[model samples]
Target: MTEDSAEYLQRKEFYNRMLTVYGRKPVLEVLQDNSLEIHKLHLADSNKPAAILDDMVKLAKKRGIEVCYHDKQALSRISKNSKQDQGVAADVIGKGFQSHQSFLSSNKKHYRILALDGVTNPQNVGMIIRSACASPINAIILPEKGCAKLDPLVIKASTGTLFRAPILRCKTLASCLKAFAESGADIIGLDANAPHTLGEEPLTGAKVFVLGNETEGLSSDVRAICNKHVSIPMLNNVESLNVAVTASLIAFQGAL
Candidate 1:
């Protein structure tokens, strides 16, 4: 890589104020996914390349994202999991970031949304975001803390879906739940202990699917506001499903 190209990718890291997404695929996806101007791009090693890598170099140039070449060790050090930074990273300008108020509407009774009380896993969060983007859900509300952001692991796990979805935020789960009620979206508490099955209820109306943390599920305070509850039947010895699978099941099948 030329000295100028090396300087380019180094600068792309500046776009990550609220997010620090890493990995080659995730970074590339972010670079290709959005047209927003970027500061720079980081690459593992593009000095010597094959057909694919050569083409990738051209694309990087075409997008106006400065390309920097670093070794595998450097790339790994920069990634979230230190897994697959591949020699590529970027600092980009965020397209848009929405607030909690923007997620609500006073005039509508049928507004589909998602409220995640304490989801912590970036992979699960990314999967849920992928599901939400595919479903009719209007937006996903995540706590401002103790939750995943636009981490590279999430961006990779989300398969670039993060670029399309709108994730809202609140300081606390209770405040998010309160806003849900005031906004007129039915809150569906998905609990293993809940008696009602998601299938038994009419889920066509505007609703918010509250996916909880892996171990504790929804907190006592958060579940109290639920207008309805859902539980998938446990067949055989299976106790439960992953929260993303459960949520996706409810989103696609519940509405049918």
Candidate 2:
């Protein structure tokens, strides 16, 4: 390959392995995380000087990470969500982050996977990730959108478990489930009204437990595609458990 082609390929590979984290404190936290490798740090040129920003820059300099300054619009483009990016972003290559294609290609054994559908709460997302990380599940199939962004709240809520949990990033939950189904994995959705209880179900081979939204439960698109629905047996007129709690139970059970 020509030098220009080689350079383009190198840049593409770097981006493919990176996930951009935006915001002041969040970017700073990523910089503080000794386990993570930062490919680049992005700062908006329009940002006024602040103690935290200066610390971040100092930390980056101490770590020998290259810092890039961009205009506000350009930084937004790097973050992909202008309203929420908060004028700061960093390209991180954490061990926990991986693409669906990469995860699928690397994993060849029968294992349980947690697939989140429309789960928007960062705390719940963080807790679920912690459970998955502590359990026997292979990796979490986290959609790129329609869920909580992997921001500072998630990192804090997870107690930094988010940095170590295995994750397979996808564009959408539906698309990730479709790919899992095509790969011969059983797609099971958790439902309060389902006939089968989770404890009683005979889970076999590769399976993915689809956890739904905090309030609405599963989306229609996800429900229609689920091979089976499993419920947790409860008493005392309790309607349901929190999505994160349910995930923990399922994850630990799978581990057993």
As a TM-score, model 1 comes out at 0.67
TM-score of each: 0.67, 0.89
Which pairs of residues have clashing backbones in candidate 2? none
User: lDDT (CA) for every model shown?
Assistant: 0.69, 0.85
Query: Which structure among the candidates has the greatest lDDT?
Result: 2
Residue-level lDDT tens digits of model 2 in 154-213: 877887777668888787788888887888878999999998998876556788999999
**Candidate 2 to truth, TM:** 0.89
lDDT of 1 by residue, 1-256 (tens): 4545745534422232234456545555666664555556766774356554565567779877677777767766655455545555666554433556544534556666677877888899889888877886667777865577567767767776775666665678788788778767788888887898877866567788788888889888888888888888888878779988986776566445
